[model samples]
Structure formats: C-alpha cells, structure tokens
Target: MSGAATLLLDAGNTRLKWALQQGAVRLHQGVADYADLSAWQAGLAALPAPAKAVGCNVAGPARAAALAALLAPLPIVWLQAAAEQGGLRNHYREPARLGADRWAALLGARRHHTGDTVVVMAGTAMTVDALSREGDFLGGIIVPGFRLMRAALAQGTADLGLPEGDAVDFPRSTGEAIVNGALLALTGAILQMQQRLSQRTGRTATVLLSGGDADVLAPQLQAALAVPLIAVDNLVLDGLAQLGAGDMPEQDA
Candidate 1:
C-alpha cells in the first residue's frame, strides 16, 4: 500500500477522473471526457505502473471497459454499494440499488469527517445524502444540478435560452435569473438536509460537499448555513483510495 501507487478511477456521468496515489500523497492525477480519451491515454503513458487499482463506474460498463482496455494486465476492483463497507452501514431500502458513486463519496466522507454529515455531490445530478454520527447511510434525495436545470429550462421553454450569467442578489436578466435561482435552490436543498440530519442526530451537521459544482455552491452554502462545510475535489476517488488500502468491500458485477 505504501511502496507502489494505487490507480483510482471515478467514472461520473460527464467525466472520468483518475489518480495515482501512494498512501496519503497523490502522485499524479488527470481527468478526461468519456467521449474523448486522449488525455486519459496520454496520462496512462506518462504515469508509472500502479501496484493496485480500484474504481466505480456509474457511467456504465462501456466506460469501465474502455478504462480496462487502457490499464491492461492490472486488475481493478470495481466496488459496488453494499450492506456495509469501510465502517459505514448502508440503510438503502435495497443496498445494491444505491449508486456506486454516492456510496464511494460516503466512504470518503467517513475518512475525512466523523460526525452527523450532509454529503452533497453536485454534479450532472446533485445528490444530498445524510450520514449519521454512527456511520449510517440514512438515505438521500437527488435533483438536477445548476447546468441541468438551466438546460431543461432552455429546452422546455421558448423564452429562456441557456445563457451565461452570474448568481446575483436580484437577477435582472433571464440568464441571471436562472443562475441565481439554481444557486438558491441548491443551497436550500442542502440547508434542509442539514436541518434534517441535525434534527435526527441531535448535533450540528457538517456538510461534506464534493463533485464538479461544489465551488459554485459552497459560498452560498457557507453564507447561509454557517455550519461546517468540508469541500472535497473527488470524494469518489478518496473512497477508491480507501478500498485500495485493505478494507475491500464485496465486489459487484
């Protein structure tokens, strides 16, 4: 676990982020699009041979296959959501039905923080999950992210075209309106989850925010929540890193 780097891949809906990490230090990392593998391929050429590999493929098996072809010979442990793993218990009605990416994020969150937490992965789809102090996956809700919301509006409505704008105090233009509305909605959902988790745990919940849109959502959340917020670049990979260590979860095909 310490000598050779562990290759970690997190296949999201929109992107594939890969990293080579040895113990606590990340040796090399890069991201690439599923449709475009040039960077990923180039990265493979530049990266040293890793000792181990772990991944979660929420983008489906095709992407996993593509990655597997690239990292030929080195076997990867593609972890699925299980009843329990890495000390966190899954309380999903059907444990395997839970998204692999979300489960990984929770495992990563457990590594970073030990408290009542609202785990938010704001990506193609935003997932707001509740993790209790005792490491229980209490359930979560999913909603369209800012870009998806704006795109849906642009597609569904004739007036509101998907225009670039900023989140402001009061939006004057259609673009600004969409941007501000998305931010408000994102923060609102997070705050509500924080409140719910706090109410259930009887302790203030720390928001573990991750994914593509975390930076955009964090400021608004902090200003509104005033509770602890730990922003992670890629919690799924962190989860993969944990798996690479020794506490491997039951594999799912």
Candidate 2:
C-alpha cells in the first residue's frame, strides 16, 4: 500500500464523497449529491484503477447498491460499526447500532489526536462524539442539522418559511432570527458536550469539526467556546483509508 492508491468512499446522508489516496496522500477527491448518481459514477469512472476500494455507507441499502453498481469489477469493502477497531472502542449497547459515518469519524479523530477529543460532524445531521484519552468511545449526541432545523420550522409553520440569512447576534428579521437561533442551538450543543467531557474526564477536550457545514459552523463554535477548533476534511474518508491500509480491522463484511 506504500505507492498504490486506494479508493475511499463516504456515502453520507446528503452527499457522496470519494477520494483516491496513495498512502496518506490524496491524489484525487470529489463530491456529489446523493441524488446525482450519474455524476458520482462518472467521477469514479474517470479515476485510475485503485489498489483497493473501501467505503462506509449510512445512506441505506438502495444507495449502497447504487454505489456498488458504479464501481463495477472493482470490489469495495463497505465498513460498519464494530466493538473495537483502530485503537478506538465502541461503547454502544449494540455496537452495530451506531452509525457507520459517526464510527468512522471517531476513528479518524483518534488517528489525529491522542487525548480526550470531541468530534462534531455537521452535515444533514449533527453528531457530537466524545473519545477519552485512552481511545475509549464515550458515546455521543445527535441532533437535527441546520438545514433540517430550518426545514422543520418552515414545513411545520405556514408563514415561517426556510429563511435565507446568516447567523447574527441580534437578528432583526425573521430569516436572521431563524438562522441565528439554529446556529446558537448547534454551537450550544457542542459547548455543552465539551464541558461535560471536561468535567467527566478532568482534562480539557480538543474539538475536531468536520463535514460539509463545518466551515460555516467552526468559526461560530470557536468564538462561542473561546477555544481552538480544528477542522478536518472528509474524516470518514480518512478512516476508510485507514481500514484500507489494514490500520483498522474491518467490520460487517
């Protein structure tokens, strides 16, 4: 696996991200909406043959099958949540019940940090997972992401539609109010979890933010928490690369 490139796919709820990696170096990376299967397939087809293709899919069986169809002739190892892998433990009562995306993100965080860390993935849904200094999975919290939050409010009410505005301190308009409120909710959740992790472990926690919306939320979270926040791109793909390199054991054949 030293000089060979591996294909890594992270089939998330709203987007499908793929990367061609040679060891730790990414040669190519691309993303497409889940609805645009053709575009994703074309992107994969354009890449050179990889040594191995590995993926973690939380988009259900239909999307999984669609991905399989696109990577014809090349076998893909679709990863799943297991009891333990890549020096990280799964604390879920039913280990397999944990989302593959979240599990992979946890493993990704462990690869980069050795201390108590909180991983926040802001995508279609926001997930905040805690990992102890010794790489123990401390479970996590899940909440509706910004888009869903806004959609819920808009769809649930007649006049209040999905607002178009950035998050502000004192929102004067309806759109601004909705956006700011959602941002606060997300940031507040991360801050609360960070505080909880510190109290429970007696050590300050490092925050790792990832996913499509991370860029938008990181600054707000960092400003609100008044602490450094690290944003990593395609964390799920990083973990998948680890699995491909045999750094982590595969789960759910």
Could you tell me the TM-score of candidate 2? Answer: 0.94
Task: Report how far residue 6 has shifted in candidate 2, in Å.
Answer: 1.2
Cα lDDT tens digits, model 2, 1-253, are: 3677888889888778988988878889888887777877776667777877888888889988877777776777888788988888898999989998998888888777778899999999999998899888988999999889999999999999976887777999999999889999998999999999999999999899998899879879878775678889988888887887876444423
Q: Residue 120 in model 1: shift from native, Å?
A: 0.7
Backbone clash numbers for all candidates listed: 0, 0
Q: Score candidate 2 by lDDT.
A: 0.85
Model 1 misplaced regions, further than 4 Å? 250-253
**TM-scores of the candidates in the order shown:** 0.95, 0.94
Scored by lDDT, model 1 comes in at 0.88
Clashing pairs in 2: none
Estimate every model's Cα lDDT from 0 to 1. Answer: 0.88, 0.85
- Per-residue accuracy of model 1 over 1-253 as CA lDDT, tens digit each: 3578888889889888989999888888878888778667776776778877888888988888887877777777888889998999999999999998999999999888998999999999999999998999999999999789888999999888988888789899888888999999988999999999898888999999998999999889878887777998889888888888877854533
Error of 1 at 117 (Å): 0.5
